[model samples]
Target: MNTDVLVVGAGPTGLALGIDLARRGVDALVVEKADRLFPGSRGKGIQPRTMEVFDDLGVLDAILAVGGTYPVGMVWQDGERVGEHRMFDPAEPTEDSPYNAPWMVPQWRTQEVLFARLVELGGRVAFGREVVGFERADQEADGVTVRFAAGPDVRARYVVAADGGRSVVRRTLGIGMTGETVDPNPLLVADTRITGLDRDNWHIFPPRGEHAGYLSICPLAGTEDFQVVAQFPEGTRVDLSAEAIRAVVAARSHLAPESVTEVRWASDFRPRAALADRFRSGRVFLAGDAAHVHSPAGGQGLNTSVQDAYNLGWKLGAVLRGGAPAALLGTYEEERRPVAGQMLGISTGVHRGEVRRGEATRQLGLGYRESSLTEETRTAPAGLCAGDRAPDGKLAGVRLFDAFRGPHWTLVAVGVEAPELPESVRVVTGDEQPSYGKGLFLVRPDGYVGWAGEDTSRLADYLDRGVTR
Candidate 1:
């Protein structure tokens, strides 16, 4: 089989990318080694920035329907209730930033939501198709032949290794990863059902002895299951059996062995933060956990991964389906790697209790200010700038997000003159916007401000220079 792009792995990253590509009429294939989507509740916190990406992807309503706001954390020690703990700092919604907090949705359910959206767009994901390796005559070649473990090799002009941290494609391409172990202790995470715990708050059990570590049980929003996290000292093997889980709950919290009624899915991993040395290897590009692995603290891993896909999907669509230069793909690494590095530090700091899950964890502040694609032509601007996220607001009876929705470019002319843009670049003219002050903003398909200026002369030049070709 042949395709324009072959996306490995059907996790959230691959599925989200496939959905974006499919909607743009790009011929893409998503394949998975496993027979079904991931069944765990890992990476459950959906940051506000990611929620914006979902809104553009046509899955925000469904995501909101299947998820709820995070509950307050209730602490316990020696079987006695203690004070409440807020996992994230509170922020009020504003006219520009509506989503102020993380939404609690099980990772598995998030994947299901994405998969359903992809299927709705007629995207295909083949299961049981494992990529063992890939081949190309030249390093910078036209196509790559990806060999599978159980099926015919597929050819693609570009390949994305969203296969995850232990990415077979990345390793096969000999890309080295640079990172360190964030925590020496091993941790266990499981989706379980408990009997005695109230679903109103996240139940926390502090370590009582030197040998024991912290344990927390958080009620999974929109479901009966509670996600259980337990830490063990270094060099100790974790038992994933139901009995071990029950015993752990009985020993740490006041809950008895019978409280853990069901252990649906469980996994163990040591906390670590790693990043691939390079995101692209010739025809293949690394995204999601394939590009960077986080400590899972402050819930940055999956959110970063989804944004990685969000950033790449539009660029790929531009090159393959919208007559853009292939060099447009180069900016993906330039824009995402630094963001990945920053998120890694945030995750590690949060893991070590040195950082708070506040504005940083929300991820709304992240942007590509230094990217080569960004052109800050304004001498002195206020509020939003080039390489910043285009804020959502209503102006002249038009919602900015409503205009920015779908796979298209948006030119927000707020209290400024207009430009003669191509038919592809949709223009939203407004007299005033508090977030945008007297400038022409060229918003990329991924919602980042690509160009900003006081005049329309440079706007056309930026768009004509292979940006909107």
Candidate 2:
């Protein structure tokens, strides 16, 4: 068997990459070790920047339809309702940034939505096909051969290891993860059907003892189940049984053991931050949890993982279908690894009370200003600059996001003459864009400003030497 790109794991990262490649008419095959999709609600918080990515991927409407904004946190003590506080700093939607708040959609439902979109685009996923190792391809082969535990070997032009933190492919490549434990305690997370809990606010229980940990029960949006999280002291053996979950809820909060009607799913893990030594090794690339594992604080792990796929998908499409050089692939690691490191720090800080869940957690400020691909030619740049995220707004009776949609680059020629370019690049001209002062901006397919300058020479040179169709 053969495929153009082989993607392991069917989580958000793999499914998203499959959708992007499918839209670009790239042949991508996603294989999962399990028989079905992940059934837990682990990564539930979807940041604002990821919402924009989903909008471009055609799943924004579905995601928004099924998800709701995060609720306020209500502190409780001795069964009495205390004062309430905001979980995240509220930000009103501006013309340039529409989705400014964090949305809540369980990790399971998010993956399901992405999988449905991938299927709609004619993408394929083979389940129960666990990747054992890679049958190293010769220099003349031009691709790698992947071996499975039970199925025949499959060859591909490139392999992406989205297999998760316990990534078999990453381990086979001999990549090392270096980091420290964010907290010395272990946390037990579960989805449960409980009585006596309002769906309006996230219930929080402060620690009663000096060594005791905290407890939180958040109403999972768009569902009847509540996500229960409880922390335990270091070296404590955490049990995942339904009975244990009920005991923890009863002991920590005012809820009775019988109030926990049912436990839908449960898991336990210690908070830790780790990053792979490298994201790419030869034709194989590591993405998502396989590349960096973050403490689920501030909801950075899954969002960062999905963006990793978003960043790599277009480059893969450009190299495979378009006439771009393979060196473009190297930028995936260079650009994403640093972003991953920053997100890891943010996650750790949020876990330890060193960072707040506001603009820093929104991820809109992340960029590639120093990337080799970015070219800032303007002597005195203003407002929007190179390598910044292309903000969303109206430009001369047209929406910038609408113009930037689809698998193509966009040239936002604001207050300047629009130049003739290849069909691969979409040009949007506006006399004045409030967010962007007079300038020519080259927006990449992933919606980041790749080149910014008043003159078209930098844009022409970038396309001629660095990018092409």
Error of 1 at 173 (Å): 0.6
Q: Give a tens-digit lDDT track for model 1, residues 182-242.
A: 9999999999999988999999999979889999999999999999999999998999999
Candidate 2 lDDT by residue in tens digits, 315-366 = 9999999979989999999999999999999999999999999999999999
Worst 10 residues of 1 by lDDT: 133-142
For the record, the alpha-carbon RMSD of candidate 2 to the native fold, in angstroms, is 1.0
List ranges where model 1 is wrong by over 4 Å.
none
TM-score of each: 0.99, 0.99
